[model samples]
Target: MSAINKVLFIAPRFHTNQIGIVKALLNEGVEVEFHVLIKGPTEDYAVLTPIKIEEGKFSRFLSKFLKTQKVNKYYAFPSFFEYFNTIKNFNADLIIIRDPGRFFSIVSTIIAKLLGIKICFYTQETLEIEAKNTFRYFFQKFYKTIFHAEWITPIGGTDTRIKKFLPFVVESRFDYLNETSAIEGYSSEKAVAVIGKFTARKRLIWALKLAQEFDCKIKIIGENTTKEHATVYQELLEYVEEHNLGDNVEFMCNLSHSRTLKELSCSNFFLLTARNEPASISVLESLSVGIPVICPLECGTSSYLTPEKTGYTYRQDDYDDLKNKFRRLLVHVSEDKKIRVECLNSSAENFSEQAYINKFNYIFKRE
Candidate 1:
């Protein structure tokens, strides 16, 4: 079990980022299995989702009974026996438990511990973002203290609450593009691109407002997967009609990962208005394609942002600040031709497949 040859990831929903992770592991000759309980139709999927797992009636009922709406979309967990058997049969050298705050991760933690398996807690959460989730944040605290993993690896969280951190690595499909194509894809146009889940937290409405005010073309892409999010999506559509923004703004949904990036690649820049976004894979995806990003402060992926070089960061939830920074970024991009090169360099040094494999080695070395 001390070896790092095999790995298991148990996540609530399947994200395109996981495909990158799985491929990176496989390239290193590590056997991997991703047990997905939910296939989020709106997760900006690149390809078809994998692993069509079978869930019995009782397990599905219990999972739904304990579901929390705040996690976004519905998800289920396999029965204890199935989860236990999967871990036992895989007998992986390393178990990367993501969303340590979720019920599925909690159950997996206890089972992994009972079987004496080694685990490395992988999270995109900073404590500040966790606190936003309230009760689940508390559950994360309890889980950390009680269930004890050998290591805690986070994706670009600088929160001091965690004593030590081995950075979690991630990349996008765009990373494979040649430098010429990557640079060529960034258009001279003024259109701003926004992509992610169509939730209030993602601030699609705010992105629309900015687009309308600037009188710029906007490509808004994401899925409205839940009833709660659907309301927000409707509001976006209504705003487009009411403000006569139909000509300026375009709405898209259920786009494959490549298609999303392709759409974004042609934009002047990428805009993310979310607050407390814990290490946005979306941000890195934009950077990978040589598109500069405009995100809020505390966006974990902003670690790659170098003031006026790659992109810029605004104060979270501050629309005024966002407007001000957006103006500054546009002005700077017009003057700075080096943004594209800088963006690609940042993506390669931070979230490339090489980076993922390098950070992965640290989990085994953790004391």
Candidate 2:
């Protein structure tokens, strides 16, 4: 074991949260670098150097074959040569592979081991619910073992959730580095917040229905990841215009984290329409800001929702169920003052930026 002075992060895409984490690491006096292996150029950040990965046809086919098509297509995938070359060039003390299930990660782990560099992988794959004998299930199990890293960081932040997907893993291997949020107090307004990327997976249409039916304001905040999603946003605007709901519907695109949290703090409740969300950082932020949430039971974060206490959970992708739940909640339930304080306390104790930094300072130490 030696001192960990430098670390390298390999990610598919570099978002705001990732940037924050890197800045925190830098503030701790660790030299941080990133290989953002996505297809396009990365936005310049002062804290870290982000290098874009160039993927060839063979790498793309292999990524698809490994059933990591979603991550590879949206973020970026590295070829074996790319991974080896990047690791060789950096000479970082530790390597953090953001997604363990990707084909390139398996190669990265092998290369890191050969170089005697400490490496760990962060995983968000929920494969326990997958049908047995399916290709995806097999691939997931296969990759889990092939990762062969020194540690595993499961994003679920629970033993049960991690076990459900990766049952064979040991407790010691679970490095629970959860995301963090800042709670800037709360204000109850007649508004519902819908936050996250403006992608098809978010199921924003369901949230829009609530705004259409209810009298309160609906705030949709997020950036479009693609042209198709931008068109979806446009169609949503058209729907609002046609229904003359412009006064109730407000679209705030690509807000900074602090600004988004400020908007979330004023809202009455946050809405989650994504049926199969692994876990939402926005939902955590909502809870941190003392705002309750209404999420589908299928969402990983739904486990945090306590009915009539913190928030509510409807059936997955059931608009009728969500509508009924919303109606009942709007009429019967308001964010209780005690519940708001409790929510803030729970989130701050568990998911604050300081807590995250403390965990990293301890765990990032080389063993």
Candidate 3:
């Protein structure tokens, strides 16, 4: 019989981004399956129906204890024999885990090895943020040793970023995939948009300042989801009032993904004031619409920025530098619709559905 040609994805939920990967695998005659913890509200992909797993009691106990110790919570722990039975029946050639938790990833890693199946894990953790304690350090070491699996992340410095914790893996093994889609072109209206949580780290206050000084129509997408966020949001509203920026800026909070897209379409440029952003989906989404962005260097998504095509990156937290860069980008935005289209096309080229499919094909074909 031919070699096994099935792939399985273990995730908390399947989002729109994963749909393309599934479709690509199906087009290539490879079977795709998803083992998810919960189904996403908008997960209506036709390629595969995800198998939802119930939480195990041991997993919950471990999760509570780990939380108290300041550790990552384990989200994927199904009944022992039932999980084993499911994997055995699927008999996938390759298995990919999304946001690998300590216990869940370790368990799945062992199961894959026993089944003689290749494993891949998606991670957003970067080495820049070091482990705070010995427990965390040892946990990472254990996971790395047991999994020894392929890591898929954004293209930037993910390889170097994970080096301090996972030094054994070769550079070639890193699969950088930031999924982006094609969108209709929109002309620059000299309006700017910012989308992110209203947390202190995101530096919305800086964006508020930009709106005050820059004198542009700025729209912020996000709501206060936490107590900390509510405090920040309140402060932002006060700043708008004190600075008389009420007319220039608007906070479009709690919007659905489709509505967010609609808001992006109505603007000319996107702005990111994050102090420590790790690969922002909002930045990629803005670029998908052909709207250029102005982000600080600390933002991981800035790696995708090409001064000649996409957008510019300023020094993090440097108000002067950010202002200067924003001024320059504003000039570009006012030029022609073709320039915007070109940037949008460039982003699509960098993170297209076909590119995502090709990467999976490479992984599946590898020895």
Candidate 4:
């Protein structure tokens, strides 16, 4: 329904997630082009970085003032003209910008406004009602007014109260999982799966506690925490030894994507132990495989979870609450056979590649 013909997306970095959107646009007869400002770990994808800013003390200082983690990112004033020309030559009907509050975003907004091009911003920032009276609030209002740019978020900024602060809202998520075969072989003997590195921030030890208290099996799948690895890895091993959870817990490392899905196929249920995860893709991957997810309330994708249907959510700060929710999910995993199908339906409905494409088109349609 969106009158999309030709569009340009500007971002600081591009990842695999953008592939679905591009393919969808192409399929819809909408010409699409992307321009990024940073390089990923590899050169496997086709991307154009019009400007490169050298990382230095000055860049880091500006990033601190902006409260941004991208310390290496800055405005390459010298390349402004060249970047402007590239964007102008694209001749896009609408421009989409991600990574708001960065120098690159501001510069692109200014250029797009000058060229009289319609603009949209994509963000992951959560809506905070308490900050309404702050200077940041007024600054945001000014920015939105001056640039005439509407904000779109894949996570957060969806609450009706916050819509008054933001010009408009799209209460949806854009998470896309690759084609998945739902795991129909969930077994009683299978362990509850937790996926992530053995990092302290991930709070994987909680999964261990579930195994210890409930006499259940646990599968910890991710990179790191092998026999001889970092301290956190050793710490996990030490806990396994001290609690005699060696048999109760299993560790897998450096698995291929297909292999990981295969492991998930047999899991009793999936548990996301990380706190304040903006939006963990593991939850989507788990849902895709037809396993219920137990994730923290602070996770952005927690919005997708419908209790007793998809999965249950608990507060990240409350350890007891997680145990309670997992305990409840554990019961359903054994007593209910229909949850797998429901989880699969939820994945296809919300997080599949097609679903993401539809959401993108809807955002434009609603425009």
**Number of the predicted model whose TM-score against the real structure is largest:** 1
TM-score per prediction, in order, is: 0.83, 0.75, 0.77, 0.77
lDDT tens per residue, model 3, 1-367? 2243788887766654565467666776778888776764444556578888777888777666555532223454776767777888999988887666655655666788888787777665544443445565566556656767666655353353232211111111011211222232333333588887788878888888877787777889875566877898998999999999988888977777667766775676788888867667666666666677888776766666677467889888698999999888777766554655665566665665555554545544533
Instruction: Identify the superior model by lDDT, candidate 3 or candidate 4.
Output: 4
Q: Which lDDT tens digits does candidate 4 get at residues 1-367? A: 4466888887776644454455556666778887776765422243233333334345455555566343425442224566678778888888988765767777778788888888887665555522455676676667667788765655552433222211121111212222332333446578888887667778888888889999999999866734433667778889999999998999887666557766776688899999867666667667766778899988866777777777999989898999899889888877787787787777666655566555566655634
Ranked by TM-score, the better of candidates 2 and 4 is 4
What's the CA RMSD of model 4 in angstroms? 5.5
Span of ten consecutive residues with least summed lDDT in model 1: 155-164
Model 1: CA > 4 A from native: 42-68, 72-77, 127-148, 157-190, 225-230
C-alpha lDDT values of all predictions: 0.70, 0.64, 0.66, 0.67
How many clashing pairs per prediction, in order?
Answer: 2, 0, 0, 0
Off by over 4 Å in 4: 1-3, 15-23, 37-78, 128-137, 156-185, 223-231, 256-258, 352-359
lDDT of 2 at 106: 57
If candidate 1 were superposed on the true structure by all CA atoms, what would the RMSD be?
3.9
Question: Relative to the unseen true structure, what is the Cα RMSD of model 3?
Answer: 6.6
> Candidate 1 residues 1-367, lDDT tens each?
1467878887776766566677777788888877666666545433224554455467667765765756632344557787688779989777777766566676777888989877667676554555567776566566566666653544443443442354434453344445235455434454788886777778788888887887777888877677876888888899999999988898888777767777766677889988667767677778877788999878876776777777888889689989998888777766777777787787778767787676567646622
Clash pairs (backbone) in predicted model 3? none
